[model samples]
Target: APDAPGATLTALPSLDLSRPAWRAGFDETPATVLADGAAAAGAIRRAEIATCIALGAECVGVAGHALELTVDHARTRHQFGRPIGAFQALAHTLADLTVTVEVARSAAAYVTRCGGDERSAHTLAVKASEAAVTVTTEAIQLHGGIGFTWEYPAHVLLRRAHAAAVLAGTPDQHRRALFALVDER
Candidate 1:
């Protein structure tokens, strides 16, 4: 990625937040700002699809984390002289989480691989949006009461998914894009 004019010459290989002075100042952004901004907007839409796929992957990871924690809690957290997770409710939850993770992973991967065309962009948006909601909800559910609590990490992931689901474009926006793309054909 070459610097676009006002993009500063840097010794580092990445954007540096440590030195705010070198960052794009208001004055430096006059010429390429609009063009770069437009490019960025378009890129965000595309990359958001990829990001949604990545977030879904994170959901799967969270599922595994939840399972491991569930196992640990089952062994340590006692209820009626037994682990609470030994209950059928807990077992079913673990199973459901596993299934949810698998489904999200498959859906995200499918959309990423298949949705490269203008037509598929809409589908990608749809899947990413859906994945954001589905994955966050399931992740929260699998974590039980703690999942809802502010102290828990699941909420962070859930929030991220929620935000990702809506960014770049909403589901309706993507649907409209699909229609527009098709209409152009």
Candidate 2:
């Protein structure tokens, strides 16, 4: 109902271009007993896994859009009497990124379809987030100094990807947990 006990919601400002975020600050706040504490940890884990899976999808969408923007720019923005997309180097890079995005997309979809398999959820999150960051960064670079500008969407995509990466747990944290899980098996 009300803000959870001592949890004060704060609107966080950022250079994320458009989407704003919030933080819940919990101090010596009052506690309202919701349910049994024993299962809380398990519930929290499931929630985190679900959140990561959703964020993975979001990452795919952002990366895919950024890739589209880069493709369009490469086709229209000419250099040295030809489109940059015509260059072998840039073409190869684009092709690689395209494959990466597609793979990430499929991974995200697979994890979602599996109902967020705990073993693979974090991995997919890491993959999708990294893919988004990679594509958006390249999108900006391909834009020639305009990528990070306030007028560019690449910066927004990058910001969103970073935010998503950190929301459920950073890639390093996810990888660490994954490694630990592997070790346990």
Give per-residue CA lDDT, model 1, range 1-185, as digits (tens): 23554555435332222222233333354363444577888887667556544544544454445455555655677779887668898777667655655565565566667755444545655654565456556656755688787656666656655555564567787688778877888
Query: Model 2 — which ten-residue stretch has the worst lDDT?
Result: 1-10
Clashing pairs in 1: none
State every prediction's TM-score relative to the real structure.
0.53, 0.88
The TM-score of predicted model 1 comes to 0.53
Summed over model 1, clashes come to 0
Clash count (model 2, backbone only): 0
Q: lDDT at 51 for candidate 2?
A: 86
Candidate 1, which segments miss by more than 4 Å at Cα? Answer: 1-29, 33-78, 111-125, 128-132, 138-145, 175-185
Report residue 20 deviation for candidate 2 (angstroms).
2.3
What tens digits encode model 2's per-residue C-alpha lDDT throughout 110-171? 88677778867878888888898888888888888888686668777888877776778888
Q: Which stretches of candidate 2 lie over 4 Å from their true place?
A: 1-7, 26-28
Q: What is the lDDT, from 0 to 100, of the residue 165 in candidate 1?
A: 53
